[model samples]
Target chain A: MKRVNILLGGPKSEYPDELSKSIKGIPGPWVGADRGSLYLLEQGIIPDIAIGDFDSINKKEQRLLKDNIADFKKFPPEKDDTDSELCLLAAREKYNAQEYYVYGATGGRIDHFLVNLFLPFDPRFLDFYDKLYYKSATNTIRFCKPGRYKIYHENGMKYIAFVNLGPVTHLNIYDAKYKLKDFNAGHPVSWASNEFLNETIDFGFESGIVAIIQSKD
Target chain B: MKRVNILLGGPKSEYPDELSKSIKGIPGPWVGADRGSLYLLEQGIIPDIAIGDFDSINKKEQRLLKDNIADFKKFPPEKDDTDSELCLLAAREKYNAQEYYVYGATGGRIDHFLVNLFLPFDPRFLDFYDKLYYKSATNTIRFCKPGRYKIYHENGMKYIAFVNLGPVTHLNIYDAKYKLKDFNAGHPVSWASNEFLNETIDFGFESGIVAIIQSKD
Candidate 1:
């Protein structure tokens, strides 16, 4: 399986201390979106492909990137698709990768962060929801469909929450510190701040999509 | 009209440059949640009421707050309602405030931010959705029920976006740079990055809750 990771151009203020250790050596090629290319270079990991408008970075950095990076595709700044979306498209078309891990999509402007949450709604990216993920040092967000899923306990994030992406029915949560019986959520309710009591967490829903956000304070 | 502004203890990393000027003398009593009280004190503003667990602040600071502030409510750390919720309740019950402007709700843990987004879902808060707002330096988030509304343009935030809090039908947008006719959104899709062309934006939806976020980069 070909796996790809995407780096966005979000603010550097909220980068958790553990990000470097968590992504030090993963199993795939990296793609940079906008200022993420500069971030990737700073982290001593050169991306295989760089995509974005390059508006956030200055001309000096852009020159340096063009001179060093072998494959760089720049788009007009006013284009319809965000740089993050273009990066995913490049990853799929060029690398043929269906699985992706995303970084730098949070901790900046709320509008930008919120838009990233809805990227899976696009018709082109609909089928890849289960495989798409947004990760940071303290949090991991995954989109899920109606199905049974088991999540292993991890030391990094202490709390697991289910946020409704749409109206959900017969939602069941089990084996956690705070367990819930079959419940229905009509809106994008936050089933928040649940701790993992055992080694694994088992959860399922009869219908509707959800985004599971596992995080630590 | 009794208007109260609530400040939370969320991260200060993304505070916009124009926040100070924008909120200089807004007519309202200020309330703080947790460390937000200390933040307000630092800014030379004494909160009318401070509400939180007080775990995030040191003992000396807590003592100082007790010595200065007349009304302070401390809750057990393990409570059902978050500090933000307690502060809002106080604003309503004690101050009889139906309108509120919130700060320090964004740019923190995803779980915390996500919970702030769902505050209006509670039955007690249903009627206060339009009057309740979460305003950060870069973004202003407001919840609204199904109805026709007009949003005036503000200097601090140039872009307006609509996100579905629930399934919305017959949504329409007008007098904006990027206009939309009657449309339906089944999921929490982000209709983001729309610019305001005229002095106001007119929009309406037939059913369900929606959140409007106006922001600037």
Candidate 2:
């Protein structure tokens, strides 16, 4: 399946090289959203398609991008959907595959990040949740709905957490240092830092979407 | 009525002078959570009591804090609520605060920050939501459930966005450059930037916990 790539622009002090490298192997087109496009271009990683209203960039960058990219859609500053979000919507309709990968939507404004996390919970995004992979410099978060997943982690990562994106019941974790069986992992109390014992772990659940966050400090 | 000052340390990068000057003038005792204690200490602003399990701090910093502070609670590293959340809970039960202002909760970890934004939405916190404020360097986000708020911006900050924390509804943003009588501020369309015709702008809503992000830049 052709994978779709999206890079979001937030207050990431770091350059976009590392995140771009993660998607280097993807077998599909890449797109940048608003500030994300600027960050990538400044780092010498120009995306194929750039979306969103250029409210965050100066006039110079806007003119330069208009000349460089294959396609650029500049929306009015005041419009529906966040810039990255607009890209995701268009990707679903355009891509030949079901899977999608999103980057740079992790940090910055609390509300911004929260909404990024909440993206998979939306019905439109949920339909493709099983196929989405979001990565940051130190972490990768995925949405697994009502199924088991075999996950591996890099050594020396600081933490890993799993939270019920919906009303989850019977969340079981095994082959990890911390194990839990038939327990609730919901809004208030999430399963955090259940590390891998054998360098690989398996998890299964009966219902609801679970967001797994594995991190390094 | 006695006011209570709670410092929320989720992961904010900077704290401006205005927030410090205002909190320092809170006219009540101070409560610190996790990284918030370090921030206040760096600023030479001391807290009367500190709470939270201290999961975010390094061992050395944690030791220095244990050596210095007297009225601090150390819970198990694994807990249900966030450090800021536990601190707020303790602050409410112990101080019976008439009002509260939280700092250092806006910047870090999108999940933690998002949860903190809706902190006031918690019924436990909501009992006193009108008395709470969350301030960052650039913006101030506060909660007023299912009602209207007349937000005034300073220094020509020039952005007013309303997020639909609840279901889709008609949100009216009046007396602004891009005035909308009844617009469906879609869930994905949370952040809106608009110029002000007048210094003060008005926003009215019907339901859900709403956050007004009045930002600059």
Candidate 3:
């Protein structure tokens, strides 16, 4: 699978350690969005493509990034798409990336976080559901279409949550600490803070969009 | 209006300073949910009612909270309603509060944050759309029904965002840096990172639910 990791300019936690562990064996092209390029440089991972308005980084950092990266696309600060959106476009259109993982797309600023949250729901990105992810130090978020799904157990994360992006119907969960059967979330309600009891969790829903988050404190 | 503030056992930031400013003149009864009671005690504000399963708090904290507050309702760890949901019920059904402000309901866990985000979208809580809020140290989140609304400028918060909880049609924004006129968000997209340019913002939609957040970094 052609997995692409796109770094965004949002917030950071105990990132470097977590980043190393999260992408231990998954080797893919790294794309940076604005200040994310500087972060990649700090982590000693040179990006293949640096795309954004480049407003968040200082002049010195910008010069350093330009000197290091060859395929860099700069835009005006005032634009229709956000810096992250532009990076996603480059990842999808330019590289035709099959699988995408996004980092630094959440935390600190709720506006940016909300923008990332709604990205999966955008009509233009609908087909990328289940293929794209919003990853952070503490959480890994993925969008799901209505169908049966199985999740294998993973360490380092404790809680599993399902957030309905739209009205969800006939939802079911099994082999989890908090099990649900034929539950319908009328709106965008959350079945949050659930635990993994068995080696895997089996879940399915009839209709609507869902976001599953495997999170740790 | 009879406004009541409910604090949940979710997450917190440099809360005291921001909480003090957010509710400086908004004097009303305070309610606590589970560990939220301990947080209130730390702030030297004893709650009128403490409602929750009480599993998140230590035994010592529970004892101290019981001695500090006169009214407390404890439930089993496994229950139908979330601790925060029970607190909202007390605020709405028991106290008959006209307006509610929620704190300590977002920040740490995505599950809890998702629960808080979907509270206003619940069928039982739909009638209280404009009256309920999920407030935190950095952001103030409120839900709006389909109607024209005007928002006056507020200090501290520099950005305003609109996230569609459902498909929003005929959406409009005026007096802002990025104005939207007669546009429809086909899905639950975020109109994020907008600035207030005219000391106010006027927005409305023909249908669907909307969450407005006044936020800062």
Candidate 4:
């Protein structure tokens, strides 16, 4: 299975250190968005493709990106989609990977974080919902459709949360530290700060999208 | 009109310094959630009521909270509502304030942040939608219903974003740096990082809740 990793320009503190340390171990190509390209280069990893408006970086950084990256796509700063969204679009058009791991998509400005969090809920990006996994230093977020899911614990991630992006119905969670049954939520709700019982958690929902977030302090 | 301020247990860096300086100026009582009570005391402001599970604090901190705060309501760590939610509930029950200013809510664990951001959308707390104001050091977030409204720019907040909490239709933005008209969003979309042209902005929507967030870098 093909896997693609896309990095966006979020706070450096939120970036997972393991991703930088094991860049060669991860499968598929690396796509960088805006300043993320500079970050990849700083880590001595050359991105396969660099895409963004290039507004955040200085002229020196821009020159570095242009000289180093073979495939670079720059758009006007005034655009419809965010730089992160544009990277995802470029990844879809170019790589079309089955699994898309997103880094530097969380933290910093609340507005930016909100956009990244809800990008999957947008109709334009709904197809990428199940495929996308948003990973940060402290959290791993993924979207799920209506179905039963058996989730295994990620190393060092102790807290599990199920957030309803929209109205959801008949949500049931079993074999977890906290269990909910036949819960019908009318609006967006974050059932946050839950924990895994042993190594796995079983959960299912009848309708609407649920964002499963596994996080650690 | 009665106004209340709620402080949650988020990162100290995210808290606005102005809030600490102007604690005397803000009207009504103060409510602190869990470690937030300690934060309030550290800021030299005594909360009128403190409500939470108190799991995040140590024995010394708990003793300090009990000694400093007069009205303290503690619950078991394993409870239905989060500490932040519990504080809001207590505020509603005790004060029934028209306006609620929430601090120490953003910039933390994604799950915890998500829960705080979506708390206004819950059915139980929907009544506080228009009244709740989430304020961090760099951002101010407010919720609005489907209506034509004029938004005045907050001091030092340069960027304004309209985030659709759910499905929204006929959304229009006027007199802003970036403009949108009659946009139909089927799901959550954060039209983020838009700038302000003047002192005020004109915006309207036909349906669904919209979160207007103003932030500065």
Location of the lowest summed lDDT over 10 successive residues in candidate 3 chain A: A14-23
The better candidate by lDDT, 2 or 4, is 4
Candidate 3 residues B104-164, lDDT tens each? 7776677777777777767777767578877766677888999999987667888888888
* Clash pairs detected, candidate 4: none
Per TM-score, the best of the predicted structures is: 4
Of 1 and 4, the candidate ahead on lDDT is 4
DockQ of predicted candidate 1 = 0.64
Compared with the true structure, the alpha-carbon lDDT of candidate 2 equals: 0.68
Tell me each candidate's RMSD, in Å, in order.
2.5, 4.5, 2.8, 2.3
* Segments in model 1 whose C-alpha atoms lie over 4 Å from true places: A18-27, A96-99, B16-26
Model 1, range B9-54, lDDT digits (tens) per residue?
7776555543455555667888989988887777778888989999
Sorted by TM-score, highest first, which candidate order results? Answer: 4, 1, 3, 2
Candidate 3 regions with alpha-carbon error over 4 angstroms = A14-17, A20-26, A183-186, B14-16, B20-26
TM-score of each: 0.91, 0.78, 0.90, 0.92
Worst 10 residues of 4 chain A by lDDT: A18-27
**Which sequence of candidate numbers ranks them by lDDT, best first?**
4, 1, 3, 2
**Total clashing residue pairs per candidate?**
0, 2, 0, 0
Where does model 2 exceed 4 Å of error? A1-4, A14-17, A20-29, A97-99, A121-126, A146-156, A164-209, B1-3, B12-14, B17-28, B55-67, B118-123, B154-156, B166-207
* lDDT (Cα, 0-100) at B202 in candidate 1: 94
| lDDT (C-alpha, whole model) for all candidates | 0.80, 0.68, 0.79, 0.86
